[model samples]
Target: MLSVENLVVSVRRGPEIVRDVSFEIAPGEILGLVGESGSGKSMTSLALMGLLSPGIDITGGAVRLDGTDITHLQPHQRVARNCGKVAMIFQEPMTSLNPVLRIREQLEEAINVHDPRAGPERARELLDMVRIPDAGHQLNAYPHELSGGMRQRVMIAIALACRPQVLIADEPTTALDVTVQRQVLGLIRELCDSLHMGVLFITHDLGVVAQLADRVAVMYAGKLCERADVGPLFRAPLHPYTNGLLACLPDPESGNAAFETIPGAAPRPGAIPEGCPFSPRCNRAQETCRSGPVPEAHGPERQVAVCHFPVRQEAPA
Candidate 1:
């Protein structure tokens, strides 16, 4: 449903924030973009949505939605073709939803933006579709009156108010408790299944990706490190950064203790390393890792890894 090719984005007077990142999502498929903070995960999403700040520019690459190039379109033009066709649920619910507006007003605004003829009744119906009980009464409730989970749900309701074809959820469950987080995630998965919506789920949590994505893309220092199916990526991560991220996830089968973390910090923009951006923190790094451009290798189903030495799965001892 969406294809991004060699997308290079940067801010004016600043280093690139998103390097040659690329990926594709088919209808009803969820593609998870996983990385640590400052890994350029969110920046890529914003770029795709054409919502980047004033200073940022798409230095290179194209974002095609259903084979239509949308890279150079004006903001309003993008909305006309892609608004209801592609919707996004931002990371923070508290700030995403308008504090001054009532839930009904917010949702109806979305509906009207996409279909001006939609009335109050249609807005209430959307609330019910998102499983909000007493949908009619809650329409008058302001964002501040709702709990974090409810607000998140309201955001989802608004995003789905237009019945979008693709849903870009950027850390949709970051603020809620574990139980509520699970509920929200479940709702997203259920909705995707029922609506046959394509999803680009951006998050730092590997566990969430494991449970939610069909394919996974790992990014580091603004570049894509690896891309593979969820099963193969989790069982055997090809890139050093992907392995490090998996190592950091707590393994219940090994007890509840924290897993080993990758050492060192992510490089800041304009400070990325000469060769491999992850070499400083990667245990498997070799001398050559610091001296040359990493080569891209393609595996089954176009799985790609940008590394000098990709990891291979080992047989059981």
Candidate 2:
């Protein structure tokens, strides 16, 4: 239900944070956006939600929600035009929630924003929807009173308050423990199926992507390096960055002690190289890789990699 094409977000009179990034999230599908820190994943989401902070703005391209161009629209405009159409679950629940307000007040406000006639009963139902225990009593509790997992569930409840068509969950499980993290991931999967909402699940964890996402998009230096079905992308990664990331994952079969790592760090924003940002660290990097603009190559089975020499070359069509 969401289509982002050639999206670009840049600092005012400065360098770009996200460049030429494009992806699509269809109804009832979860698209996992995986990347390292400062890779512009969050910035891209903020741009989508019209929540980009001052001094940063979407400078080019378009974001269409169900065929509507909401790219340059103000936050309020987006909400007015597509009420409850797009919602976000931020990285941290503790900060996202209000310190003073009770859970009931927060949820009720969200409900009323898109739906004025909705009452406190709606708030209670929302709590139950997120599978929170003692939904009736928890509404009276402040955010501090709830545990981390409970607070995250409440955050999910608030995001679902509007029954959004598109949900942008930016590292929603980052702060929770593994057990709680699994629960939250399962909940997201269940909700996506039941609600038939498209989810843009942005995270740095490939494990989570494997568990939850149907399709995976790998981002590096603000550009999409590879995208394919989750299984195929993991099974046979075409881009060097994708291959490196998989290599870094601990392999239980090998019983190896030392963790494999990509040799170098990612380039800082505004310091990106002219061509192929990952070329410097790529073992297969050649002189041609750094000489000019890198081009995207299409591999078999609907895979696309942004590199001159993909790990596996495209077959004859």
Best-matching candidate per lDDT: 2
C-alpha lDDT of all candidate models, in order: 0.86, 0.91
Q: RMSD per prediction, one decimal?
A: 1.9, 2.2
Candidate with top TM-score is: 2
TM-score of 2: 0.96
Task: For model 2, state the Cα shift of residue 14 in Å.
Answer: 1.2
TM-score, per-candidate, Cα-based: 0.94, 0.96
Give the local distance difference test score of model 2: 0.91
Tens-digit per-residue lDDT, 1-317, candidate 2: 79999999999999999999999999999999999999999999999988999999999999998888889776568667763377899888778899999999999988887778886689988889899999999999999999999999999998898778899999999998999999999999999999999999999999999999999999999999999999889888999899999999999989998999999899998999878999999999898898788888886677899998889735437
